[model samples]
Target: MTPVFQPGQTVVRREIMRGEPWIAMPQVCVQDDGDLLVTYTPGGTPMVYPETGAFPVGEHPWKLAGSTSWRGHGRLELHWTGVEHSIFLFWDGPQRAFQGWYFNLEDAPRRTPIGFDTLDHELDVWWAADAETYEFKDVVEFEETGPARYPGRMEQIRAEGDRIARLLDAGELWWDKAWADWAPDPSWQARTMPDGWATVPFEAR
Candidate 1:
């Protein structure tokens, strides 16, 4: 299949928070087999945090606090080789560099006019900075939310999570060591979303 996102293209990555959109610009890199690799630094924008019961009585769910800047760089590899799980690597700021990797087990992204879109499965794995140790995260939340939200696909999602966990435990997964040494091209300008970015709606899964 032909890749939907091209190398050097600027794409808006829209992450939904409490039903609202949080956006970021990530530079795209298309792989030889049509997978997509996106990289971005998470600073310069106010980070949003969900605050429970922080808003007025009528605005409970949407209440949020935007303050701290995310001090890190992130690389996400979106695979096209079936099963659609993506691996994320994060390098923290100057203080605590090389935080580690996160495996996001999710649905295959659907190509949209603005960009590609996928729903996160909640279940994930975290490989520590040491690179050998790892842990399963959000299993309770995944079990709680999967049935009610995803219905029939809960079992499949769990299986996918297990598969990734095994690969991580056995040290069979592929990760680029060079990414830890990567820096953005100095000549590339900072990216901003296109005019209609906010207008593109993600279909409810």
Candidate 2:
């Protein structure tokens, strides 16, 4: 009961099979309500909680408010703190597409200092199961870093995404046109990770 966004809003994230839309800006603590206590449950020490590589994994895992669900399927882990991430998904019994994994935090050739390796970082994932979107941006031109943790320097995130895509191609505002429309489509093919994760159980959907 604590999820609300404002600052330039438009977070229509509908993920089902391949329709990943964007536009969610307003930086600096972006309207923090403690971001729902750091994305749920005792999770309130932020630093982007590994930059949004969310995880918990089964039988009520952490229920990011997706309600309650499970039939048979589990796997969750996304780590982004300077960039380097991974995603795994499953749930198909009540019709939630299925199968997912998209990571390319800069040529993920299994780079690990702790956990995460299987770098097929070519960056390609986009799922839009009717309207339940999923998006992971970064076209290509590898060499990434600068969420700032260590090996940070993808040419300084391409000179700060080319100075925010030249101020949204000169419109010069609106949060740099929401970071140049944050073109994300990476690719995933499954559905329903939201309806409160359907009771979260069957191995943590």
Candidate 3:
């Protein structure tokens, strides 16, 4: 927790699925104020793994996606202390237009020497820029992976999703247009991984 990172410093933000490394990738640190850590990855950043070689694509990627060239939209991740969910803003294209808000339901982010680790609790809530139309993203994936991923946390995951929905209904939430309008430094545009990104163990707190 004492390790401090500078803006543009590269670190590995790994997902600890089933207590082992699932997906790892390099992210440029935007800020780290102990409580709120912000990081971003340009579109097309490479995905790394603790183990070398190809990772097979599965039916449920959120469960276990293969290590391919990351074809997803460029994203900025907001990790606040002790929050049940983290907000990720996604954008694509040359204009880097605002896309949508993805509320990822996960355990509290566990700080690590490299960066942060968290077990992504399958079910998530997402809304477009309008925020008027919202939908749960991975119900099918959750049904298939939740029980096996974490034995007793499925009910808690459902409750957390409901809680977020309630807040969205009341218009009470942490992020808004301000966060959505963020733009990254042009210098951080390179799609690369850090020094130890592939070997940083997915140690859960």
TM-score, each model?
A: 0.70, 0.22, 0.85
Scored against the true structure, residue 120 in model 3 reaches a CA lDDT of 76
In model 1, the number of clashes is 0
| Winner by lDDT between candidate 3 and candidate 2 | 3
Ranking by TM-score: 3, 1, 2
lDDT of 2 by residue, 1-205 (tens): 2234443322212111011111111111122232120011111111111112222221111234433322342222332333333233333444534444332233221211111122222333433334354454555424342222123344543553444345435654321113212211223112222232212221110
lDDT of 3 at 155: 89
Compose the digit string of candidate 3's lDDT tens values, residues 1-205.
3566789987677776655666667788888788778888776777665554333332226335454555655678888888878888888777878888899998777777888787678789999886666899989989887787767888888998999999888888776458778888878864566676646555543
Q: lDDT score of model 1?
A: 0.57
In candidate 3 the C-alpha lDDT for residue 104 amounts to: 91
Each model's Cα RMSD: 5.3, 19.3, 3.3
Q: State the weakest 10-residue window (summed lDDT) of model 1.
A: 53-62
For candidate 3, what is the TM-score?
0.85
Which candidate number would show the highest TM-score if scored against the true structure?
3
